[model samples]
Target: MDKTFTYQELQKYNGKDGNPAYVSYKGTVYDVTESDLWKNGRHQNLHDAGDDMSLLIDQAPHGVEVFERELVKEVGKLV
Candidate 1:
């Protein structure tokens, strides 16, 4: 079964200090820790992990293709 996370629980993986990085999109959480672009939990120095990025995608230079391209794996769901 898929794991579930509360907003506060999901906020723990912000990628700082070499911690695992995670981000939520459309209520699904993805493990972005292994991604080079997400070093230190920051994506392109603009976006950070541990939060919902669904609304931020439109502002990104690219589209949903970024997820497929990165092959980011879903880890859980936001409660």
Candidate 2:
């Protein structure tokens, strides 16, 4: 079963100070720490980790398929 994480709980994995970076999109949390783009918990200096990117993603030049294409690991779901 997938684990559930509240927004508050998710913040702890912000990929800062050796923490793992996690981001949410459409209620699903993805582990983006391994992606060089997400280094230090920031993406292209435009987005931050520990955030629900559902809205921001819509404005992105790419679609949600980037997640699948990149093979980003799904860590859990947002509550």
Candidate 3:
């Protein structure tokens, strides 16, 4: 079953101090640790890891399809 994480719990995976980098979109959490674009838990110095990216995604140049691509892995769901 997919893991469920609360906003508070999601903060623990901030890709800092050896923790894995995770970001949420539309209630789903994605593992972005493997993406170079998300180096150091930061994306292009614009977005940070462990954040609900749902809102910011709309402002991005790309669309939600980016999440459907192999760029990131679905890890869990956000509550």
By lDDT, the best candidate is 3
The alpha-carbon RMSD values of the candidates against the true structure, listed in the order shown, are 1.4, 1.2, 1.1
Kindly list the per-residue Cα lDDT of model 2 for residues 1-79, writing each as its tens digit. Answer: 2799999988888989999999988889999999898999999899999888999998988899868746479989999
Candidate 3 yields a Cα-based lDDT of: 0.90
RMSD, model 3, all Cα superposed?
1.1
In angstroms, the error of model 2 at 28 is 0.6
The deviation in Å at residue 55 for candidate 2 is 0.6
Count the clashes in each prediction: 0, 0, 0
Global fold similarity of model 3 (TM-score): 0.93
Q: Which pairs clash (backbone N, Cα, C closer than 3 Å) in model 1?
A: none
Lowest-sum lDDT 10-residue window in model 3? 64-73
Residues 1-79, model 1: lDDT tens digits = 3799998988899998767899998888889888898889989989889988989999998887666655588788898
> Which scores better on lDDT, 2 or 3?
3
Question: Per-residue lDDT of 1-79 in model 3, one digit per residue for the tens?
Answer: 2799999999888888999999999999998988888898999899989999999998999998877767688999999
Model 2, 47: alpha-carbon shift in Å?
0.5
How does candidate 2 score on lDDT?
A: 0.89
